[model samples]
Target: MAQTHTVTIPHFVTEASVELTHLTAAYAMYGTPHIQPDGRSNILLVEHALTGDHQVDQWWGPEIVGPEGVFRTDQYCVLSINTLGGCMGTTGPGSIAPDGQAYGSRFPALTIRDLVHFEAAVLDELGIREVAAVIGGSMGGAKALEWTLLYPQRVRAALVLAVSARASAWQIGIQKAQMTAITRDPHYLNGDYYHTEHTPQQGLAAARKIAHLTYRGELEMDERFGTDAQTGENPLGPTLADSGRFAVESYLDHQASKLVERFDAGSYMILTEALNRHDIGRGRGGLNKALASSTVPTFICGVDTDILYPYHQQEHLARNLGNLIGMAKITSPCGHDAFLTETRQLVQIMHRFITRIST
Candidate 1:
């Protein structure tokens, strides 16, 4: 298990200058810290996706970061910080407010840049002035990209997978629908449902179902379930209430329920809102100009079947970034979630990228 640590920032001002007092950052580190001759730790920062926490090994584990993993603990110091507005041990809607209640509905808005700023502060507290590499996928990828731009001198390299420089209209539209589902739930209680007996579990489940569809490939979905009905349920029953469900519906339901049991609905809303606002070029001029200005070594990867963030986004980044080695296409049937599902392929790509930079 990774050891958890917290750093208290007396005053954390957001990019918009929103004052956030008494901010706390929760993070975990793997492997022993190895200080380089240049006074910086030989560290590799791993940013997690939407529902991920500092527990990188739990989801990524031996497949990505253990002794047998691509980023072996024995080789380099590995660390992961729970992003700002995260539910798991990080400051978010579930965290306590100055008024002695959960922030809940009152939690301030956040952006991808704000998350990178928070991570920078955490790194400062740990005396980590620079990192060997920064890596992430999806929402995590947005942060990794931001880090390369925000602190170019501090980051030696960055690996971003399954994300874009900015969230597209299609992405925002889907997120808006998910947000609407959460707010429309009767139990949402205007986002201040912490003290209530019921949370917006049903609403969150609906949102997850919608997201799950986008996370998976259409061909894979059809191959797995096709037109088959769930064994115990009948789709064409006499009564509508007694109608059976399709195999696909059952799979989505399981995914939804699993999230509801482990995640906070309010945090989900905040993070999704943050994701919708992800724009690496914001306030830094235009996308091409912004990427072209950065000299940090960057490795871009995209899922060939990803519908949410298509491979073209990575292609664009590779074309523009001043210090890029081109984009690596991860071929998998898992769609947008291929970064997490296709571990072996991801490892190979990352290994090659790291080797090229090191040599």
Candidate 2:
């Protein structure tokens, strides 16, 4: 297990000018330190996707970053920080406010840039002047892109997978529906149900179910389940209420229940909202202009079957970015979550990029 470290940011202000005193950022480091004399580590900063923490190997599996994995510990120092709005050990909605209450609904709005800024502060505290590479997928990918733009001199290279330069209306609409599923639950109590006996577990589960559909590919789902009834249960009965669920439904329910046990509802909402607001071009002219301005070498990859963030988005990023090395494609049956599911392909692409950057 990776040990957690924290840095205090006194009087931190958000992009919206929301003031937070004594802000804390929790991070975890892996790999052996290869620090230079100038206070910088040969570090590769790995940002996590939504609902992910700093436990990269634990969450993403050892094959992605283990000793013999693509991100070999002996090769480079790896660090991952929980996003500002995350729940795991990080100061988020679950954290206590100055008034001795959980921030919950009162947690300030967070933009993707705010997350980048918070991590940058933590990096400064760690005496890391620059990172060899900053890599991520999904929301993580957005942050990786932002790091290159926000501190072009600091990020030597970036590997962004399964994300776009801006959050699309289609993506926002899906997220809005998910948020609605949570807020509509009475137990949510306007995001202040922390002290209550019951949290919005049902709503959270439903939201997860909806999100899972988007995360996986239709072909994969069909091949896996294909309207088949769950074992020992009949799909058809006298009425729909009396009928047992299909195998796919059971799988989604399991996924939802798993998340509900570990994740806080308020944190989920806050993070999803932050992800919805992920626009790299915002306040920086436009998407093309913002991307074209970056001199940092970039590797943009996308899953071919991804419905949420399709291959075209990566193509656009590759075409617009000034220093794009190449646009790689991960051909997988999984959809948006292929970055996580297809580890072998991801490892290959990442290894290639790391090798190229090192050379």
Candidate 3:
């Protein structure tokens, strides 16, 4: 088990100018921290995706974080913070407000940069001036890239796998569809369903289903399901009005149900909005200006079969990053989540990346 830690933010004003106070950040540390006399060590910040928490080993698997893993806790002090506006131990919509009620829908709009700022705050409390590297995938990948631009001096290397420089219209449309699924649910109650009999289960589930569709890919679905009906359910024999579910539909339902059981719907919306608003160049000018200005050595990796955040998106990043090490490819049929699934392959690529940059 990893050691857990918490840091308090006395006060903060977001980029959007929303004021907050007494916020708490929940995080976990792996391996023995080697804080030097100057109060800094070899810190490797391992970030999590939208629905992930601070427990890196559990969700990411041994191929990523463990005694013999590529991260090598023996080599660097690994830190993983539960996302700020997340349903995990970190403070978010369900956290208590000054009035002692849940923040609920009143949770301030948080940006990807804000997430990096909060991570910086936590490092400040720990007296760490810099980190050896920042690594993550999906939303986590976005945070890793943000760290380089937002706090370049503090990060030595950034590894952003399976992410875009900014939110694309296609990505936003998919997110919007999920947002609609939850907000339009009769039980949503404008995101104030806590302690109420009415819960937005259906809506949240619908949102997850929509998201799962994007998380996977066309080839994956076709190969795995391919018009086959789920066991014991006959879509062909059933009446048209209440047809049985297809194998793919059943798969999506499973994914939705799992998320609903563990994650808060309010948090889902907030984080989705954050992803929708992600842009490295938001205030720095534009994509070209932002990527060109940052001198951080950013390494990008992409899954060839990922349709949600296609290989083209990463190709664009490689061509544009100001100080790119190079681009690595993880060939898998697992779609966008392949970055998480193909840990061994990722470890090999990263191993090479570190070696090349070292020489």
Candidate 4:
């Protein structure tokens, strides 16, 4: 059985009231904190990607968070937070407002900095003034980058894998299209139709389908699905839906429906816009200044086959940051999703990186 702990921290987000609202953060402590009785806790904050929850062990396997895993709870206190704009047990746009209504379209626009600020509040509530390390992947990586900028002294080290310092213009363009697909649906009702009779299923599914293609690489799609038909129905059939179905289409449909069941459309829109507006250098300075500002030791990882966040982006992080301790390049055929699929390699990288910072 996994030991669980929940704590409520003060959170006054841009979307809500000015008064400090209670926020919930769930965590599982693995090992004891490496500190004196009165000293600061040796915490390792693990940030999750989009659609990911604090159930990192469930998604990746027990070895990644167990007594022997890189995060060995028996040796270190590990904390993973569900981000501010996420749906997984955390306070998000899908949550009920103080007036018992869902924030829905009324949820404020959240930046990556907003997420970092809330996370810092979590630490404050936990009596942790500083962390031994902060680690994340994908959008989680973006959060890690923001953390280094917002709380440089609080973090002694950073581990960012398979992600970019900022969302590219190309990435934002795709995100806009996804948002358009959802809003065009008559059921969306400008994001406040959650309690209504109809929900934006078609638009949400279409957006997911579009996103599924980018999450994978062309080579992976070609090798796995190719141009083969899924339903085996003749193209000359009467109805278009039954006329022809490609294997890739079937795969995408499965992925789309899965997200529709687990994720809220309103939360998706809010998070998507946040991602589109993501630029770590927005008010701070350019990438160089942002990286230079962080004094924490850094570990960067890149996936060779990733198309969404290419390997060069990792190189850019390592080059711009002055205190880079190591760079791990994962060679996988799984593309951008390799960080999830290639668990062993990720564990090894994390183990080495964490060990270096602990001592």
Candidate 5:
């Protein structure tokens, strides 16, 4: 019989002997060591979706990281660190500040670059100077882009999926509307409402509803729930008390409630607002100029059905990446969520790319 033991992993702050100025920052790991007999490791860093946790393979499903999966844990070490401003184990508004209370709305404004910095700190602590590849989709993809830009030497290649170089004006507009809903909520309590009276569950739910629509395509929505009526009573309206709600509305409600259970309102505001501030060009010059600085080879992928980041964005990034070696756009009806849905296609492409590059 095999013996079982419990072990505590070392924190990055302790390992590096450095102080993390942020109120919170946590990370998780997966797979066996990627070290060769010579002692060098091939590492894959996966960035997660907006509400995603560090359990990448688990959340996205085992198809992406199992023994026979594209990532092939037996061959390479995989790391998926929750973003800095996330409500996960990582530091964020929900974390208690130095003042011994939650940072709340006072959490420092963080950008994708800032999240990359946190990841770099983790890598440095782990003595990993170079990663075999960085992979991400949607918000995760944004972080992947920043990683290549900020640490060109450390990231050998980046796989950007269903994401743009910068958040578009339309993206900003939608995010702003979501923020407005949260702020306008009487239960928000100006963000310090933690342990006070009420939480902004309703407002956050509304935001999730809007975001879920963007995550899927119009065709998908049409196919899933065209004009079917929900059987539940209308809670928002006494007038609709007799009439049935649309199936689409029911689906959105399900997404919203799911988010409400695991997500924090203040953190949502902070992260989404930070996403709005996402731009590699901010201080480095412009988008094209910033990307030109990266010496890393890039693998840019898009979903043919993605409306949020759209396929053109990936094409533009590939054109500007200079050292891009692979470009693919998987066809799926799932839109932005296709990356999570179509693992088989991504697996084949990634396996070839990783093997070719490692050789």
Candidate 6:
């Protein structure tokens, strides 16, 4: 297991012009950074998804971040930092403001660029001159792309998996609905529920259920659950509310309950909204123009069964990236989550791609 660390940024500003007096960034590092006199090493910056913490090993699993993982400490320094609006030991809605109270609903809106800015701050503090590669899947993928576009000089290559250059309308709609589920919860109390004994866990759980449906593939769900009720439970018990849950329902319930335990509803809303605002082209001209500006080498991967991001999005990226290292696909029925679960496929791609980039 990797240990996490924290750094307090003296001052920070958001793209929307919101200035934060202080920002605490949580991070984890593995292996020696650089041995050369210049004090720079081949660094692998692994970003996490929406609800992920700095402890990438916890969510990314061992195959990727373990001691003997792909980006092993023995060969390179692996760095991970929690996003700005993250709640896992980072400054977020739950963080206390200079006024000595939790920001809660008062936390300012954030953008994907803001996340990159937070990351840059952490790197600057650590004196990391440059990174050999930046890689991630899903929301993490978005950050990887931004690093190439915003600071290509600082990154040699990047591998973005399971994400588009911009959040699609369909994705934004889903996030909006999930945000509504949280805000409408009676216990939410309009984002001021922090001090209250009752929280919007029910709302968060509902939101998670909605989100999980998109994270999984349709065929995967069908194959796993079908019309079957959870083992020993009756789907037709006469009364719907009193009836036993379907296998699919049980799966979603498990996903939702698990998220509610680890995530804050307020942070969930903020991060989802941030993803909704993710557009690499915004103010940098059109999508193609912005993409053309990223001169760094890049490789992209997609999952064929990913209904949320879809395979075509990856193709779009391949077509536009300035220096495409080639694209690979993960053949799986697990959908978007395949990026996380399909370790063997991922290892094959990284082994091929990172080997070239690092060399």
TM per model?
A: 0.97, 0.97, 0.96, 0.92, 0.90, 0.97
* Residue-pair clashes per candidate: 1, 0, 0, 4, 1, 0
Question: Over the stretch 1-359, how does candidate 2's per-residue lDDT look in tens digits?
Answer: 68888888776788999888877888888887677886556788999998888988886787778777788877777899988877888789879998998887888888889899998988888778899899999999999999999998889899999999998999999998999999999999999888789999999999999999999999998999999999999889899899998999899999999999998888889888888999988988999999999999999999999999989999999999989986789998889899998888888898789888888
Tens digit per residue, CA lDDT, model 5, 202-318: 999998888887888889889988877676644345575556578788889899999999999888987787788888787778988887777888888999988788899888898
> What are the lDDT scores of the predictions, listed in order?
0.88, 0.89, 0.86, 0.80, 0.78, 0.88
lDDT score at residue 136, model 4, on the 0-100 scale: 89
Q: How many backbone clashes does candidate 4 have?
A: 4
Model 6 lDDT per residue over 1-359, tens place: 57888888999889999899878888988777773556446689998899877787777777777568887777888889988897888899988899998898889899988999889888888887688889988989999999998888778899999999999999999989999999889998878887889889999999999899899988888998899889988878988887998888888999998889999888898889989999999999989888887899999999999988999999998998879987999999999999998899998898888788866
Write down the TM-score for model 1: 0.97
As for lDDT, the candidate ahead, 3 or 5, is 3
Question: C-alpha displacement of 124 in model 3, angstroms?
Answer: 1.1
- The C-alpha stretches of model 4 lying farther than 4 A from their native spots are 1-5, 15-22, 26-28, 31-38, 235-242
Candidate 5: worst-modelled 10 consecutive residues by lDDT: 1-10
Model 6 ranges with Cα > 4 A deviation: 35-39
Candidate 3, 146: how far from true, in Å? 0.9
lDDT of 3 at 289: 88
Residue range 313-355, candidate 4, lDDT tens digits:
8898889886888999988888888888788898888888988
Clashing pairs in 6: none
Tens digits of per-residue lDDT, candidate 1, 172-206, equal 99998999999999999889998889999999999
Writing each residue's lDDT as its tens digit, candidate 3 over 274-347 gives 99999988888999788888788889999999877889989988888899997899988778988877777888
